[model samples]
Target: MKPSLASNRRTDRYQSKTACITGIVAAIEDQASRPNAAERNRSAGPIV
Candidate 1:
């Protein structure tokens, strides 16, 4: 059976959002562990 277009779009949006959130969390964790905030921020880049 074929999937609906709306469902596909929703799934895509959810995946992208999840990825963005995950990246942000990782960046935060890195910042907490590392002393250099500047480097962590740079590594995080657009994710934060």
Candidate 2:
């Protein structure tokens, strides 16, 4: 069988949207923990 012309582009868009949402949530959490962000970052490993 051959690959379909309709690829995963549509699903990719949805996945990007979800990523945006998570980014927003992380932003909010960062704000909420603004004071400890530096300390947390120091203790935490580098993000992938």
Candidate 3:
């Protein structure tokens, strides 16, 4: 069924905000661990 924009607006907005916050936190944590990472130059991040 096609979703109704009016009904989904609040839910979509909440999800978007939540996703942004989560992504930012994850990025910060990933960067924080960089100094100790054995291989910092890899695209996949520190190679354990």
Top of the candidates by TM-score: 1
Q: What is the C-alpha lDDT profile of model 3 across 1-48, one tens digit per residue?
A: 334667677777777788899998987788787765435557566648
lDDT rank, highest first?
1, 2, 3
How big is the positional error of residue 42 in model 2, measured in Å on the Cα after superposition? Answer: 23
Best by lDDT: 1
- Candidate 2 displacement at residue 32 in angstroms: 0.5
Cα deviation of 39, candidate 1, in Å: 6.2
TM-score of each: 0.61, 0.53, 0.56
Per-residue lDDT tens digits for candidate 1, residues 1-48, read 234566787787777888899999997898788879867567887653
What's model 3's lDDT at 20? 90
Model 1 Cα shift for residue 41 (angstroms): 5.3
- Which residue ranges in model 1 land beyond 4 Å of their true spot? 1-7, 39-48
- Runs off by more than 4 Å, candidate 2: 1-7, 35-48
Please give the CA lDDT of all the candidate structures. Answer: 0.77, 0.76, 0.71
lDDT of 2 by residue, 5-31 (tens): 675877767777888999989978886
Q: After superposition, how far is residue 5 of candidate 3 from its true place, in Å?
A: 7.7
